[model samples]
Target: MNDGPNDTTDLFFRDATDLAHLIRTGQTTSAQVVQAHLDRIAALDPAINAIVTLNEHALDEARAADAALRRARATGGGPGPEIGPLHGVPFTVKDSIDTAGVLTQRGSPIFAGRTPQTDATAVARMKAAGAILLAKTNLPEFSYSTESDNLLSGRTNNPWNLERTPGGSSGGESAAIAAGMSPIGLGTDLAISVRGPAAQTGIVALKPTHGRVPMTGVWPRVPRRDWHVGPMARTVRDLALAYSILEGPDGSDGFATTPRGVDTGVGPAPQRRLRVGWFTDSGLGPVDPQVARTVQRAAEALRGAGVDVEEVTIPALQENNPLALFNAQHVMELKPAMAEATAGHEDEMFTMSTTMLSIPDTSMADYLAAEQGFERIRDGYAEFFSRFDALLLPVLPTFAHEHGAGELTIDGQVVDATHVQTFTVQFNITGMPALSMRFGTSTDGLPIGVQVAGPWHAESTVLHVASVLESLSPVKDQHPDL
Candidate 1:
């Protein structure tokens, strides 16, 4: 590897898969890799402001990892019987997720100085896999806003332009990975938290099938059925690796339906022709022409690679409008949850939290109707997936916009900004597995990501298709200038 100025940058840029291999083979020590990231954070994080809290024991654990590798090398010719797939690699967690002994403020003064006695199930699993926790990234207050700014941790800036948002409630996690502060991370998705932020940052993120990974350690338990926790990284392969290790029942989460120890590999399966459906508009909001073209390019790329690709749309998406459906049911439900969380600390609540309180609550009748509407959407997807194996669509209707940028103007027609979640929230409602990965770039040079979603419990198919798209992507190994 080349040395000097770019050396640390090189270390941080490599995906978790490559970094773990290097560490396991003794070509590089875990300490070196971990410190390279810490050094990067020390030098560059001031401007990006993604990472909010550091793991005090990360270097110590990395050193322990290095020692374990030495012992394993002396005993056997491999990474050792004890080393897990993520052995020695460093990772970050969104603050909304718990980390034992580390501050998890949840981006609110209400949660400031709050630290858990044990890691969230996901964090513990990563630790069990030998991945060291490097830090805790920021989020919107109570993880409620589409942006990552909060009264407690301030705001996280996009690594790409500093002026644009990285997207939230997982914005800090995406921004950190994009800036090389961390290779892989853990994030939650209620609506568009993980995938949206990943799209904004030019990285890869997976929101596994609802309950595929448990929600034992994350906050916002009111909407237990809708929230999901999964992986985010610089490369699709890293996401696959993290997902394999993170999947299955934790025994504690009732929502986790997948059997324990289920790891569906991302590689090709038995011989079968896969059909992928592509779309730009979901019939809810206007999609930017560039975003539409990117989706088309991805479809054409797959077609050229010998995969069957067809332009299609789900009627339910256009009729029900998942984003609106989500708001209808969740607004009333979540407002109470937020109220409960901020009961004694009302003065500490952020604008998003207060604004949500002002919105009228849905009646039991309308809430029930919204729930039924979502079921029709689920049925619609089940029928749609019967024909296609996966979907290719835009993660965002347009490229990253300025922080708190009000109203999205698509093709000169202004629309509500929340319409950005038009494509992603559908998967959350249906409990399908979906992912975001960089495929193309905007004219102004921001990364554009395409969404790949599969039927429930079909993450392996999703990853397999994503791996192909990753190889055929028009943009690769591109990083922000931070």
Candidate 2:
């Protein structure tokens, strides 16, 4: 791993959309695009440990894409266009999501040699859209922890600071993208996986309305409703592009019942003002002052853009704690699944798997109440969105921290570390679409992200608002030195 500045050319850092355009226009070959990313992975992955498996056929696929594009050009781009919108772009996936013929270890020793016979619906969709799979990223054991570490693949370090975590269970995806090893990738968001890690790594991630992307072939299906498969990338446009491909049911994942909706376009609505509500303290815990300021700044930026941005609190957030509710519900539901997976391989369990097994299960009454509580949270967000088009809030109460952070000090007040999911898990339980993008920097110089969430199936609006914030963000094009 190179501990100093990355010496790779700008090609590795280019967004997936740009790479696709280059390939489409014959400015660059898919082979060169794939080679650039492979080179970056070879140069930087040793220190980051973000990769669990590489798609050995990636270059072959890129070559095939180039040939297809050439054929299309010769045919005058006729009849349905032989290539896809993402033709020739390279992408990655979290190890928890299956990749046909590739290892899908779920970051656990018990499933160390596991390989799926088919790609997850999201992966299949990405491939169908002409993206070459670059690699499979690391995750926490069974994607059960906030830090991406397990007995099988070790830990993933943040590109900003090696000692600090990139945030998980999608940490590997975030780290790989931030370091230019992957232009874009797919991630599974259970509680805070996709969005939180994006915040830490200063990238953009979108957890489209739950079920927008099917969770087919992803692990921990016990709590099927919350396993959201979404895209993470350096730009919001990439998220929009990927989401457009990943949505719609695959005839599996019953929760993915919503039919494909019309694309609302990610541009500003000129006829009406978009209303956005942002808040710093929603009562999850005392947030870091810097994070609070970042949220405020995002709200102000939107206001300056002619958006109706307000600082308000939701009664649902204040009355119901998503962090507590997630733990209460998932712990009981997930333990039995872990038990089955680790049955004979108990000795191979990591702290995450073992600790989960040790926890007492929730009583049936409490479990039922928690289910209702989740519904109430969903209803609250629904009511809030009835008046507002979007919401801007901190993705986490603070910036990235060192690995194994069991506790945190926010604004000089000690708080449970689990509060890290305070802002993120709300959408997880509600199945609302939310995004995490860098809007500010902390005193420690790590990127701080603000969450932009929308009501059910409102991804286009969420992306539009995020794009505006992205363009106006003061912290732009800042990559980690290494």
Steric overlap count per candidate? 0, 0
With candidate 1 superimposed using the best TM-score fit, by how many Å does residue 165's alpha carbon deviate from the native? Answer: 0.3
Q: How high a TM-score does candidate 2 get?
A: 0.96
Return the clash pairs for model 2, or none: none
What residue pairs clash in candidate 1, if any at all?
none
TM-score for each of the candidates: 0.97, 0.96
Candidate 1: where is the Cα deviation over 4 Å? 1-7, 261-267
Per-residue alpha-carbon lDDT of candidate 2 for residues 363-459, written as tens digits (9 for 90 to 100): 8888888888898888888799888888888999999998998999989988877889888998988888899999999888899999998887888
Q: Which tens-of-lDDT digit does each residue in 1-482 have in candidate 1? A: 22222455569788888888878877788899999999999998999999999998999999999999888878887665699888999999999999999998889988889999989999999999999999999899988878999999899999999999999989999999999999999999989999999999999999999998889988987687889998999888898889888888888999987795454433366366788999998686788888889999999999998888999988988888788889999987788888878888888989889999889989899899899999999999989988888899999898888888779899788988887888899988899999999998889888898999988888888998999999998788888886
Best by TM-score: 1
Q: On a 0 to 1 TM-score scale, where does candidate 1 land against the true structure?
A: 0.97
Residue-level lDDT for 127 in candidate 2: 89
